[model samples]
Target: MKDAQKPDHVSLNTLIMRLREGQFVIPDFQREFEWKPWDIKELMRSIFLDYYIGSLLLWKGKQENFNALSCERIYGYPKGNGNPVHIVLDGQQRLTAMYYAFLAPDVNLPNRANRALYFVHVDKFMAEEYDDAFNYDWLTRRWSKIIDNPEVQYEQHIFPLAIMGAGGWELPNWVQGYEQFWKNRTQEAEEAGDADAIEMAAKSTENAHLFGEHLKGITEQYQVAYIELDQDLAVDKVCDIFTQINSKGIRLDAFDLINALLKPKGLQLKHMWRAAASRLEFVETEKMNVYILQVMSILRQSYCSPKYLYFLLPGQEKPVRDPDGTRRKEVLITDAQDFEGRWHNAVDALQAAIKLLQHPHEFAAISSKYLPYVSILPVFASIQAHIKTIQASQRLDAQRKARHWYWASVFTNRYSGSVESTSARDFMDMKAWLQDDNAEPPLITEFKTRFKTLEFRKETKRGTSVYNGLFNLLVLMGARDWMSGNVTLADDLDDHHIVPKKWGAEHLQGKVIDTILNRTPLSAETNRHVISDRLPNQYLPDLIAENGEAAVRSILESHCISPAALAILLRDPFTAEDFEEFIAERQRTFQEAIETLLVKERLDLPVQLRELDEQIEQIELGLRKVIVAVLQADSQYELPSHILRNVKERIQRAAKKNAALDGDYYDTLEGKMEFCDLRELHDAIKTKALWPQFQPRFVNKETLNIKFGQLAELRNAIRHSRSADEITRKEGEAAILWFAKVLK
Candidate 1:
């Protein structure tokens, strides 16, 4: 009945030797080695930085212990004569990672295709850039050359970590050799009288010696703590010991820590989480529990990182800025009653947010997987709660604005990183924006800029925000089932290739065929049975015959495939060229849909006006390219004198006022071209000196004037953020189409 737990430590040098000799074995019940290359690289970094990597649990092994529980040699350990003395109960991942990295095993890491070699960037290590110092790469032919060549490794200032397991004289010899190598280069540079090369080589030599000593010191002196169990302990007792030790050692995130902190206040955060868990089960994320607290924090103090979440505990006071813009202290939760009330309110708001998100006509995030940004949930829910408190009539307008913000956040990836500050700022801005027309969140302007150039042709991944946003757009568009020709539930649809992947692989070599532009949500049955492994031309003709062209085209249009794109799809012997054209046409369709649906003004414009607007944008863009080319050829890329005095000066003034406009000359010029109406383009073209260079592109100044005047009238009306009258739309359509054709 003696207590079996004993504390122990081992120098890293001895530990590496033991691992190399296979003296310690892993228990068979242990999980498989799953550390990625990055994870292994991080461990190396921690060891080099002398950070504590936590304690290992070892059970003293005997014949009975081995017989009771099976054991295996550490993964990738070479066969050795050394006998196993201990069973690893914990730290298998760390040990295996060390074995893989220090030993540089011929075997690959788990789930990896190629063997990996780990290296320390000596310069980075010496400079204390620990995060960038440790690295690993597949032992490909290119890397093999670098690994085998000492000169290349030294030139790159990378020292391979595998030499540690070589034992005894190997590492010291490498250190000495590395220093001498750089010293020789330094001497050569001095002989050549190359000041820069001498300085560089001298630094390398110094780094070499310093890094060698530091690494050697770490290997010899670094201590790994462990808990040793007596050999006589029962297997059941060992299991219990492991469970207790591991459970205690597990790190607590903000939610778990806050839960523990709240228990003494007579508030059971765990019980509350259990009750609210079912409500948030719709989203497939473990962070939902933490998100509830974040929502509460965001609602209270407009900040929700772990630091702010601590203030939500009972009796915790956080500083706040009032609605009237006065700073004050506010107790986030006064007591258990107030704490519970806020918690439930936050949970209820999140539930309401999820309902709106999954609504087909709203964000159309029918499933958690298709939801654009889970990180946006705190702000989303907080804003939803804010909307409810406003007047009922105003709530609808407020929700419309909120929907715009949500889509903007998703498409622009605004909430992807450092969500705490972003959520706080956005929540405050959105509140202001909802109450006043002039107070628009900066994210709206960002989305306008980013969305204009968002290349759907490169969005090939399912998990990306843009990819998911596009799929959700399809859901909102009421993308119909291809086979049934009926609008289908988003849950029942899976994003499938418009052009079968099998055909693209065969015919469209080197083409990116899986872009969202070439994919749409379709029923699984339709993908398998109807469109199975066939080109769109092969299947669509049959669909058109069955459902008739009108009905089938309507279904395709719902998926954002226009008639022009359909024609490209229906092209016989659909070539890669056809695929490119189809994607281009669909890109335009999707872009238009986003503008009409998400980025539209408060008042909807006529479809003809929207189409005319798109046409004008394309025509002006093409005209700018022509103008830039002509100007570059004529003025050697210099801004024309008139433009420099007028448009350039005006833009520079604007950029001075708005920091967002600040950039280099060419950037400012591009911004000028993008923002300037048809008037500026006309002025540049009609200028006395630049007229001849632009004359060949147009018939004459008279013709140019007529077209420019037509476009200018409509552009002014649309760019003013209002719907243009019918006469302006008609004239603009004619002029835009003419210019679009001329530009093409």
Candidate 2:
């Protein structure tokens, strides 16, 4: 096949003409417009100075592929197919900036005001005697107005670059007008017979003549270069080139490529994502499009990253060599056939997820406050809620399961770093659940319940902290707006410590009041007017007097304060200071409420290490099991009683030595024994004094020591309370099973 084997370097005028005629297009997979006003100015300065900005990489597609190319133009899209469409694979930013900077307001452009705007400095080429300097100097506005109307706005030089927008920036008439005006003035001066005035007019005319020259230089020239790639290259190869060109500079965002891929099919990804993200009230908009795009990938491609979607394109069997020496065949445009529909589904799922978070049956997120883990959105969006394989009745069941998983994910932070892999896994598991009624819910291997003081404080801040998932669960249990009669919590509400900070400061250190149990959501009105010194008992009567006791009781019930707990704070005398007791009681309820929700839905995981104690598989050390297996290979290597004596004596001697060497106090027997741990015992066993206790009874001492060292590592991890990801499921179970068999 004969491709147009060369690149062409045309004048900037020809490039703009091609763009105006729809020959140049921002391909569907290119990124959304990201240049700012400053970027436009810098680019314009570079162009005016004839600086080499960069070259454009345009994929000059074959007629069929070009015909398939319907894309967003740099400014206004061309009205008719004046030339074959060529995709801009690079130099889009510079081109876009220039196009918008000079797009004429009169060109019947669609939404001209909202698309892009630019302005040019007119002071550089204005008449020195002109009074227009004050009006245009150092101001920023779109250059889409009267650019050449030198006398329109001010006394001196100012030009709207927009005058050049109508494809031909014909030179200005002001200089000529001034020249004609000065010529007329000379005649009048000569007639008046004041020779000195004539001389002054002549000098002004000379200045006017100079401005005309500077004005022509800006309007007549355009300077940008580009390389147009022939259409014979494969789509994958094109993407590779696009990525390589951008890698060292501004890296190509995957969303940009997706935009290019989708535009040919009538999907304006930027507009679609903008609409979707605006609906997300409090979740910050930074990378919101990327997140939604990832969600779309998960639903459509069963992947969380768009880069991975490249391979899913319809590839050809045989590769043909391209002009760039890349051997590749064209992939059909059918690669994006169902993208529009699937993206809509993802949007629907995202809306459903937002709603689920804001208003849930139990453990409601209420708002962004409780959405600590942002990674759950993709997994939630990929639920395949209305898959055809799912029965009508089971759809609701599947949704319920999704909800359970959402809470479990929030509790465990399941969608952390491996968000893509986790989303794919969760979606597959969720899809299976929907299709096959007997499919079990996905497993949550580990979760953490111990909220460290500082982290908990950070997490519990009303709308600011991510720790609100737990707070939301507590609210679901019964925490309600004290004055709102249990209405759904509003974003405007506030939270205050149950034990006032000033009072608790004497009893505690570093924000003793800044805790989940101590903090409770208060109505905005109450928060604004409350007396900080007043105890809940004191505040209760006033609230009851204002809103009535029945309303107050409803608020307390909604806030998850049990009647008994409220009674202690409201006892008529109310003399006893029971903030500690009150806090303890509430904390217990909070913990119980969480457990209740987890058990209610069977979405439970052992969030606490103690919960995994009875089920030792969680903390089991696999290396310990290997050591036991090697020891038990003889089937008769029971530890001698004398070895136990040796171990006990070794522990006692170590404690005494530690006390003497480190000056550690050990008055009680229990205190001395506290230093004893499995690793410590193993260390004692490894000592030369105790090594011979079972040298013959067991296997190789060297082998056992190496395995025991691994066991020591596992013991250290457990002691430090690391996540269970530190150990694998097979390793955990193997350790427990092997140890049990050997111990028996």
**Best by lDDT, which number?**
1
RMSD of each: 12.1, 23.0
Whole-model Cα lDDT of every candidate shown, in order: 0.82, 0.55
TM-score on alpha carbons, each prediction: 0.55, 0.43
Q: What would you estimate as the lDDT of candidate 1? A: 0.82
Local accuracy of candidate 1 as per-residue lDDT tens digits, 1-744: 775767556999999998887778887777888887899889998888766576677899997787678888888876544588889998899999998888887887788788999999899888778888888888889998997887788788888999888887988888888999999999999999999999999999999988887887789878776777898988999877667656775433567557766767898888999999999888988788999999998888877866678778889756565778575777878998998999999999999999989887777888888887888898999999989999987886687788788888888988778888889899999989988975776678777667878999989888788999999988877788999877676667789998988887887755578899989988888999899998888899999898899999888998999999999888897888888899999989988888877886422345555666667778888888887778667544454566556766655555543466456753645555765556777888888777877788786789889888888888778745545778877887788877877787
What are the per-residue Cα lDDT tens digits for candidate 2 across 176-288?
Answer: 66566667777889899989989967765665665455445444444344566778877778777877777756443556555654555566778877777767645654556
Point out where model 2 deviates above 4 Å.
1-252, 260-268, 280-282, 311-337, 360-363, 384-389, 416-418, 435-466, 484-491, 502-507, 530-533, 541-554, 563-580, 602-744
Total backbone collisions for each predicted model: 0, 25
TM-score of model 2 relative to the true fold?
0.43
- Scanning candidate 1 in windows of ten residues, the lowest lDDT window is 601-610
